[model samples]
Target: MAPSKTFFSNFRLSNIVNLLLRSLQLVDGLVVIGLYGIDLNRARKEDKYSDGKWVYAVTVGSIAAATAVVYAFVSVFMHYRSLTFLFAWDWVLMVLWAALSGIFGTMYLNEKVEMEAGIHRMKVAVGFDLAGLVLWFVTAVMGSLWFFRERWGGRISRPGKA
Candidate 1:
């Protein structure tokens, strides 16, 4: 959906991070489809994917939607606020985490697709999964904390006193 004017007003650094996370998921989903060899003929004829492909599509699609929402929120936020130190840090971290996840996840998917290639041993695939999981977890936790802080945390000061 196109962003609304109010979206600009509610921008937050955390929103941008969420945006990156979602985008990565979208790309990952596409990679999964390609790597797993999507049955385009079946999809077109049957109007649905094969067993596993459907799951990947739904999960990745959800992420893409969520990312779009974050994009809207961040665009709105940026409208009201300058790109200050906090904003820059948030963007940098978000991009870094997303890129890391993409790299490892792509490797994992590619290896899974071409098991006969033998370039990535079983042990190596396990390592890639572990690394991807770590990055995903860390990014999720940080994004959630930022969301909570922006949505709920605020100074509760005594009235007219410090």
Candidate 2:
């Protein structure tokens, strides 16, 4: 495709996708943090915050949001392609979100367990946590696409080639 000479046209399609996904990441992180932060505060008041699941959820959510902000600055706002290293970090973030979602999911899905009264909130958190995982996974896939397109250069050699 020929490059267009317009303000919005200057940006690549993938970059636009990254921007939208990063926006979703920011929102998912904030929602997860808000969902758990209130409980975290209450737990702290009750002296259980240090060992509470809410603490972990809030911390991971905060990190996800912070990372999304920086990534958006470098990748979208600066009009830079996906940094190769971000692929690894994206996987790491995906795993963290997966863990968060899995833990909450089990709590929310299991009907036989009567563990905590707070498990009721896990239903909402599971959705946002899973959303975080999906967002990071999509970012990682995009980064991989960039890497393969730029670095792989899949040139096949035939046996008859001299």
Candidate 3:
């Protein structure tokens, strides 16, 4: 159904969970950006220098935040659900988060960190990225169910739901 149709219809438990998860995704992304961004800004102040690692992390965090906002808005205002699109994006996010986690983890283990606070921030960043990975995985599974719903005698796709 179109988002407009769902808006006035019953508000199900799934809707609440959807909103909660999306909100968490958005916040988690912002937190990672903020954590890495502090170091990035400090580096700029010290000598107009920024580490590539922090830059890459911040970029990924920005992408995560933007996806959460855009997808949530579109799902609410345009379609009640876009299963295929959501599924694709969830997987994309999952990979990005995994990469972020792996990169930060490697960097930390390599003993290249310079400051205690920086170490703390990196650990937190990895935590958030892993959380994002799990969240995306969960959403991807939910999206998969939508595809199966059509095949298993659940609600078949309407004309434009594809």
Backbone clashes in each candidate structure, one number apiece?
3, 0, 0
Candidate 3 backbone overlaps, count = 0
Off by over 4 Å in 1: 1-4, 38-135, 147-162
Best by lDDT: 2
Error of 3 at 146 (Å): 1.6
User: Global CA lDDT of candidate 3, please?
Assistant: 0.77
C-alpha positional error of residue 155 in candidate 1 after TM-score superposition, expressed in Å:
10
Using TM-score as the yardstick, the better of models 1 and 3 is 3
**lDDT tens digits by residue: candidate 1, 1-162:** 456756654656645655565455445434433433334445657876466433443344344335435544554456312322233334443454355346545655555445554345423433433443443455545555555555555753558867
Looking at model 1, which ten-residue stretch has the lowest summed lDDT? 79-88
Report the alpha-carbon TM-score of model 3 versus the true structure.
0.77
Clashing pairs in 3: none
Top-TM-score candidate index: 2
Ranking by TM-score: 2, 3, 1
Deviation of model 3 at 124, angstroms = 1.5
Output the lDDT of residue 15, model 1. 55
